[model samples]
Target: MLTSIKSFFSNELFNTEKGSTADSSEHQLQLACAALLIEVAVIDQEFDTRELQALITILQTKFNLSAEECETLRTLAQSESEDSTSMYQFTQLVNSACSPEQKFELIKGMWTIAYADGDLDKYEEYIVRKVSELIYVSHSEFIRAKLAARP
Candidate 1:
């Protein structure tokens, strides 16, 4: 039993390490952004299947990662997103690394996650909007993304 438990944790930690190292700093910034989107999805204790699927799709498409790689990164992002209490760490990484255009794209991705389940809750929207502003996306661009992602 002890061995099983240890192995479980070992596997989890290994996945985490592998996920973090699998991408370059730029890709990691994008990964962190995606993780934040998932973080908000679970904020209300309603992690729907659709949202998860949409997140995986976006990661696969946007990052040009293989399905297996996307799954690994999604798993790692979910872990990191849940463990974090503040957005400081993620925002700091993105603000320092992402260009203005990339920041706009990131906002769009966040909106995509929020709309994944075809239901946008208030808190989720608020979190994404706040994150967009923090990441330096213009209000107009943020609104455009929000509208575009709506069903």
Candidate 2:
């Protein structure tokens, strides 16, 4: 799995440029964010079509990615989320790479996915809450994000 992730980063996600640490970091950030979103979508064990679509839309819009790039990232993230033991790895990358506002936005995206099917599953909400806490989003801000993303 580690080798697959490394190959993904090296071959599929970004073009290799000499000394391009920024690009590598950016791709890692993208993968981390996508994995979190995927986690929310699948936490209920349903993986609803609406949730998948919402996740794709959020990834494309937030990352400014082309459709193909978004799909590739989504596939990789889904695999990572399923194979993972905890959320800490993804959240750690996010905490290191994202600003406070960016973290809040990610919470909003999670809420969006949670509400995508027009029902808020407890497990979905719990995962979102866990991620918010891991990312150091205040309780108030987490509530604000949920309210704002409520459709």
Candidate 3:
């Protein structure tokens, strides 16, 4: 089943708008950003309450969203993160569209999420570092944010 999904995604026939079910750019961005956070939180497979709260906090502050809006995005992001076969689709979109500063902010946000529990797990560190590199965040800046975000 996974192979088939990958094949379908990789095929040229899947390139069109009709090829996949989800085509909403805005929705995809939200899902991608949120899911990436969730993914990092779950990289350790702990998915603790602190991480969840941190995710909600990040969403609320960054989007300037109300509680309802925060929950909506969180739910959508969680659903996608749980089911996603790959994180690249969303990361690629963010990389192409967001500014350098925004990318740096995202790295900061990822660090914030990782430190929500007051302890930085190995998996969380690995995930955020990898994601920071992918998003073009400098190593020093990434380290600084990670340290600052630490509880």
Q: What are the models' TM-scores?
A: 0.80, 0.94, 0.78
lDDT of 1 by residue, 1-151 (tens): 3244233324642333333333345455655777777876786679889888878877777777777767766776777787777888888888998788777777787788788878888988888888887888889999988887777
Candidate 2 residues lying further than 4 Å off, grouped into runs, are: none
- Per-residue lDDT over 55-124 for candidate 3, one digit per residue giving the tens place of the 0 to 100 score: 9888778756677767766776777677878777768978976787777777788998888888888989
Worst 10-residue stretch by lDDT in candidate 3?
5-14
Relative to the true structure, candidate 1 reaches a TM of 0.80
Model 3's alpha-carbon lDDT is: 0.74
RMSD of each predicted structure: 5.5, 1.3, 6.9
Off by over 4 Å in 3: 1-24
**lDDT for each residue of candidate 2 in 1-151, tens digit (9 for 90 to 100):** 8667666777766656634678778877888999999999988889899998999999989999888888999999988888888888899999999999999999999999999999999999999999999999999999999999999
Model 1's C-alpha root-mean-square deviation from the true structure amounts to 5.5
Better of 1 and 3 by lDDT: 3
Give all candidates' CA lDDT scores: 0.73, 0.91, 0.74
Alpha carbon lDDT at 71, candidate 3: 76
Give, for candidate 1, the lowest lDDT window spanning 10 residues: 1-10
